[model samples]
Structure formats: structure tokens, C-alpha cells
Target: MYDTILVATDGSDSANRAVEQALDLASMFDAELYGISVVDTRRYGDSMLSGSSGVIDDLSDRAEEVLAGLEAQADVGVTTTVRRGRPHEEIERYADTVDADLIVLGNRGLGASGEIGSTAERVVRYIDRPVLTA
Candidate 1:
């Protein structure tokens, strides 16, 4: 029932599982698959020191690597994107832009485990589309 499926990844174990799930679903439905990795801008802050710190650059590089890994693991062609902003907001916006029929993401990403990651929780709460958390 899905046409375009958007999967958000953070290179975490759970995110990797989500990628596998999204890939399977996309293949099953013969749908387009899109992968996204967001560099959380909030983590770097807006201060001048933050800009000079190179943490954002590092994060961006990590995001790119995560997307690359996702693409490599997929048997089918995967459209990948890297964005900088709040993870949930960027994911939601990208999903809307792609007109995704399903949004798949990890329930807990690179953050501390025990509960759902804030970004995934927020995406589920704010995004209107169907979200599958792996």
C-alpha cells in the first residue's frame, strides 16, 4: 500500500534494523525507497564557538557516511538525503517533500536506550503520515 517510503537513519543498531525493514517493505510493495540522515543542529548550538568547533562538520560527515552505508546495503536503488536541523522536523519536512506514503525510523537511535528517542517520538507525534518504528 506504500508508494514512496522514507526511512531515517542514525547509524545506530536500531536504525540499521529500521533500514532493513524499510528496504523489505519497499521491495514487497515495489515502492520507491528514500533514506535520510539528519545532523541535529541543536547539538552544535548557535554560538560562535560552535561554528569554530568543527563538531557540526563532523556530524555532517557522519550523516553522509550513514546514508552511504544505507545505500550500500540496499539491493534496490535508494535515494538518499542528508539534512541539517532538528531531526524530527527535517525528517517530517523531507517526507512531505517526497510525498512519502510511509515513514520508517528507529524507535531509539544513537541516543541512550530505555525509551524511544526524542526525535522518533516527535516525528510520530507531529507527522501526519503512517510511521513504522523498528
Candidate 2:
């Protein structure tokens, strides 16, 4: 039973499976679907080196492109959000802020029994909301 479902995606194949599953659930319950893709802004290898680079725009643009694809596949009531921040924290905070009934995410090849996968694993450890991993 869910009203507002939040689907956290990383633009990955695994996350896409989660998206498809969430869409099916949303359709079944006639629930509103909310999709989000988070872009981690924290500097990485090159960023840490302070080398000549301008990848933030690249990342944001790429996210928007992916989000656009997601928006196209989402249900009629589904809305899309593109955020820039820590993946796990952003997903958890957004889910809480929206008062989401369910937080659905894909297991990034890291789930085994009680042990969760990468992104989902982190979100589970911090979020108080109910998480549905696919």
C-alpha cells in the first residue's frame, strides 16, 4: 500500500530496473510516482588534483539527459527531480521532505541477505523510512 512513491536512481542499469519495478507498483496502486537522479558534486580523482577541468556542467547536463529519458517512461502522474549532492543523503532527505510512502531503489550488485548494496546500503543505514530494494 503506497500513495506517493519515491524512486531513487543513479542512471545505472540496476537503477533502471528499480525504476521499471516502481512504475509497475505505482500503476498497481494508482500511486503518484516521483523520480530523482542525484549527481555527486564532490570532487573525485581529477578534482582533487585541482587540474584544469570543468566537469560540473558536463555532469549536470548528463543527468538532465538521463532524467529526461526517465520522465518519458514514467507514469502520467510521475514527476522527475534532478539533484546534486551525496546520493544516499539526498535520496533519504528528499524522501522525507516529500513524505513519501515508499522509497524504492535498485541493488547495485551489492545485496546479499542482510548486507545491502552500495547506494541502497548507505540509504538504509541512514533513512528511517521504509525502503524497497529491487
Candidate 3:
């Protein structure tokens, strides 16, 4: 029932599980799989160390590494991306751009300290597509 499946990863354990689930679903439906990791630029406000300190670059690199790992593990071809912005917004925009049929996300990610990550919660609330939290 799914044509394009998108999974948001943060390199956290739960995110890894979500990736696995997305991979399986994509395989089952013979659908294309896309992975995205977003660097939350909001965290680094307008502080003196925001853009000039290489913090964003480091975060972007880490995000790329996460997507690379996801691509490596998938048996089916996977398209991966890294974005900079609010996690939920970036994820939603990317999903819409890809015309994804399903979105998979971890219940909690690296920055989450509760039962559900804020980004996942926001995406679930605002995005129109079906979302599965692993």
C-alpha cells in the first residue's frame, strides 16, 4: 500500500529500530525508501558559537553519517538526505517533496528525554500522511 517510505533517523537506538521497520515495510511493498537526518539549527540560537564555530558543520556531518549508515544497511536501494532546520518541519517538507506514502520515526531520539520525542510528536500532529513510531 506504500509507494515511497520515509524514515527519520537521529542515529539513536530507537531511530535504528525505526529504520529497520521502514526497510521492512519498503521491501514488503516493493517501494522506494528514503532516509533523512536533520540538524536542528534552532538549538544553536544566535550565540557567538552558532555558525562560525563549525558546530553546524559538525552536526551536518554527523547527520550525513547517520544517513549513510541507513543506506548501507538497506537491501533495497535507499535515497538518503541531510537537512538543516527544525526536525519536524524539515522532515515534513522532505516527505511532501518525495510524496511519501508513509513516514517512520522513533518514539524517542537523541534529544528526546520523554516517552516520545518532540520532533516525532510534532510531525505526527502536523503531517497529513500516515506515521509509524517505532
Candidate 3 global lDDT: 0.91
* Most accurate candidate by lDDT: 3
TM-scores of all predicted structures: 0.94, 0.83, 0.95
For model 3 the TM-score comes to 0.95
* Structure candidate 1, residue pairs in collision: none
lDDT of 1 by residue, 1-134 (tens): 99999999999988999999999999999999999999887765678535464877788899999999988888888999999889999998999999999999999988747899898899899999999999
Give every collision pair in model 3: none
lDDT of 2 by residue, 50-132 (tens): 56336666777777887787778875577778887778888988887788999988877323344456678887778888888
Poorest lDDT segment (10 consecutive residues) of candidate 2: 109-118
Deviation in angstroms for 110 in model 3? 0.4
Which regions of candidate 2 are displaced past 4 Å? 43-53, 109-116
Could you tell me which 10 consecutive residues in candidate 1 have the lowest summed lDDT? 44-53
Per-residue C-alpha lDDT of model 3 across residues 1-134, encoded as one tens digit per residue? 99999999999988999999999999999999999999888877867545485888888899999999998899999999999889999999999999999999998989778688898889899999999999
lDDT of each: 0.91, 0.78, 0.91
